[model samples]
Target: MTDTSERPRADLRRAPERYLSRPEEGIETRHAFSFSGHYDPKNTHFGALLACNEETLAAGAGFDEHRHRDTEILTWVVEGALAHRDSDGHAGVVRPGMVQHLSAGSGVSHTERNIGGAEGPVRFVQMWLQPDAFDAEPAYGLRRVDPAQGGLTLLASGMARDEDGEALRLRRSDAALWLVRAGAWQPLPELPSAPFRYAHLTAGSVGYRTVPGPQGGGRSMAPGDSVRITGAAFADPVAGEDGAELLLWEMHSPVSYG
Candidate 1:
């Protein structure tokens, strides 16, 4: 028998689109974890993250104004533009390559509509996480990302040092989100022995290695597929036949759900 101590252990899971949300609506939504009416104890969350939903809006259909509290909401546009209006006096349109972050601290109400551009329907991914400090002020912000930028870009972070280069800031001090467009090998930051990393392939396919050494395994990813990395660091991923588009999040483990 092989020795158990000879290798490092990591959990690599593939989250399919149909696993977490109702797929029957015109405004299609496929959740990656427990959300709304779909609940799975074992699939609730990872680290400090609570929800990641892949959403597509019909020509004129969209979510009416909704309310949230004590949550950090991030909306990453994938296809068309998303018209967003919030109670914080911020009304804007988020387009592809742009990521919007809304802190529903204390409490806030917002609306997302496809009112899509000439491009047609609107597609995007929304993630929610608990803020380290609850009942704080509500806030909203956005950032533009370019695939040619190379390497992983820190779109949002809870890191104490502002010099870390993430400007779309987070009120929570326990999580960060990154965006990477991998055409070639682009390695990730060094991770601790026991780390919590969530890698989502929003577009194109990706070939990723989730651990530090050769003993670790890799997977071919498709759009909407994601992997949860634990106890190991994910190396730079390589793009498949088509280049890859991704959203990566690193957070403190035993995810806190709000």
Candidate 2:
């Protein structure tokens, strides 16, 4: 594994604190929201990982007609429904318990909207991955997984595997994303020892006990909270509340990229 000093620091939160004072971005038509920014490349302590802030869109809100190039955009809807329309002419509604993926290889135009119809709020997590190679071709996909699906379900990966099955095939990188829901913990399978792990909580709470390095120690995470654990084993959850959900990513080491 690469030196732990090269990785980001780890801290636990029962729930991510809301910084209401930040400026909001209009990401779609008649829609605007704040980003819990871990987005900048320089701010990322390891590999090509970048995470956005938690977003809560008011009813009838969303971004429209934006363009992206050479990045892998992944979204996890925490609550309510998110409507996605893309240049690929793909449009759909993603509700709780679903993951939306867009590989903006060369470039792609897209928009995201909160379809709550002015009834309630919509919350979710959006992340960007720096691809090993850029400007290939754009692609889109999603996986609707139930919390009872337990263990790991591949949302997007560089290779094919049959464990929990694969959803979207990504560009050139050995990175793989796994989604875990409530009930029964599963140990992370053998992976390159130097990889970096990013864990994002979408709902309820999960306890990570005695993981390696900074990720070690008991930490409780609720929705909107995220932790970056470099080269650590996916520890079995010692305990959980009713609606726990997690998104885990195994990425190439910083040493490899450096």
Candidate 3:
């Protein structure tokens, strides 16, 4: 948890790539309907949380059926729309305002396709979380969000809530996600200051300030950027503005596994 009194700061990190495609399920792509992993094990934290910064999937171009086992995957639409089909006989469309979760416990097969029109491309985020337990049972869920409501909304949890966060309770390790839309310069409300903190900018830009570090001050980032904070600095404050749309993830340290 970052200290409430300390300001949030960050450092610049070279982005990463993972070859995830329709064929090998390559990690990163930049050509047509491009998909890129802003940060992943190949770049940052490997086998922990696969954060693929995806954007602009050409219309009609999508992934074919693929299998996944013992992985907790979440698909977040930052801009356009994406359609999903799974072996469980479930199918649905996801737009910019919503997130979809698929828990491939033992094993599950699924595919994603662009739902945007010919002229419009699909832009979104795909994350893979290593489960603490294998083959927990396959499940699917979704959560629509609006940062205008203020504070964090639990997108998926082990328990049910009365509102939007009520869905997506997994049987593996516990984790929660939140979204915030702030001006060019605003502070995030105090949080539990958990052991892990990750921020991804959906749109706009912001400056993250924190205690003096090896790089001097802090770091600044534009849209499609991400950051991971750890060590005792976990409690340091991080703020942004220029109307940045930020996605935050708090996970257990050491990334527990069963």
Candidate 4:
């Protein structure tokens, strides 16, 4: 028995204003939790997730080759395109409706560029998660999920066959990710619905509540805002007000209790 006690509850309409916003000349980012210069020891992680960063890059702007180790990095492109180059000899372009997953098992270096000139800016949401396994190998994969796949598309899964042949595999076996575009109300996929779950609004506004109760009041979530579900629950997205988009992660935490 460890780290247990509080009865499962839920938090909703959690504004993004409390998050750390890092802005630069060409890049502007709003971090969902403590990161870079922002530090909040108590708010370090949610489930198996660590960081959720909303990044916007000006045309011809980008991130230089940076290093990462023992992290499962997943990126969802919201607009325009991103040029990616990594140490594993994988180079490609990721656009809207596409997902870019990079698994830095032992270590890896990569770069991301908007490639779009001053005419267009690129927007994307990137999430970092702790892998279940460590120091395995560096790998990378990409997939473009269309609405045809379903309202909820499996972007990345650590569990084998969790994606039905259309998802990217993560080196870590503790997490699964889903992305939803605005349209018909959709049910959550079958995953470990833990006491805590993370829901991020990538674009537009959405209607969400808890699995059994009205946690969010079935209210709306503005773009850039997110919620933390404290009970075993899944949300049904009923509508997408102005091109809505969502990213949901379901996983078991390394820390457990009796």
Task: List residue ranges in candidate 2 displaced over 4 A.
Answer: 1-42, 116-118, 146-150, 160-165, 184-194, 210-216, 233-236, 255-258
Q: Which residue window of length 10 is worst by lDDT in model 3? A: 26-35
Q: What lDDT would each prediction earn against the true structure? A: 0.74, 0.62, 0.60, 0.73
For candidate 4, give the lDDT of residue 17.
69
TM-score of 4: 0.85
Alpha carbon lDDT of residue 154, candidate 4?
72
For model 2, what is the alpha-carbon lDDT of residue 38?
A: 23
lDDT of 3 by residue, 1-258 (tens): 122224343434433322334333322242111224232332434224544445457667777898988777777887668889999987889987788888888888998877746456677777776666675778888777654455555565442332344556654444566676665466555543545566666777766554445544555667666666542342323455456676766665434434
Each prediction's total of clashing residue pairs, residues at least 3 apart in sequence or on different chains, is 3, 8, 27, 0
Candidate 4 per-residue lDDT, tens place, 5-36, comes to 26554455455565646455788887777887
Q: What range of 10 consecutive residues in model 2 has the weakest lDDT sum?
A: 26-35
lDDT of 2 at 83: 88
Candidate 4: which stretches are off by over 4 Å?
1-5, 13-15, 18-20, 116-118, 148-150, 161-164, 182-192, 210-218, 233-237, 240-243, 254-258
Per-residue CA lDDT of model 2 for 1-258, tens digit only, reads 223545344444334343332334533211012233423333443455544446677777677588999778888777788889999898878887778888898899998788846487787877777777777878888878643343556677764343345466666356777776554333333323335667777666666654655555666676666665654444545335455667777776442353
Candidate 2 has a TM-score of: 0.75
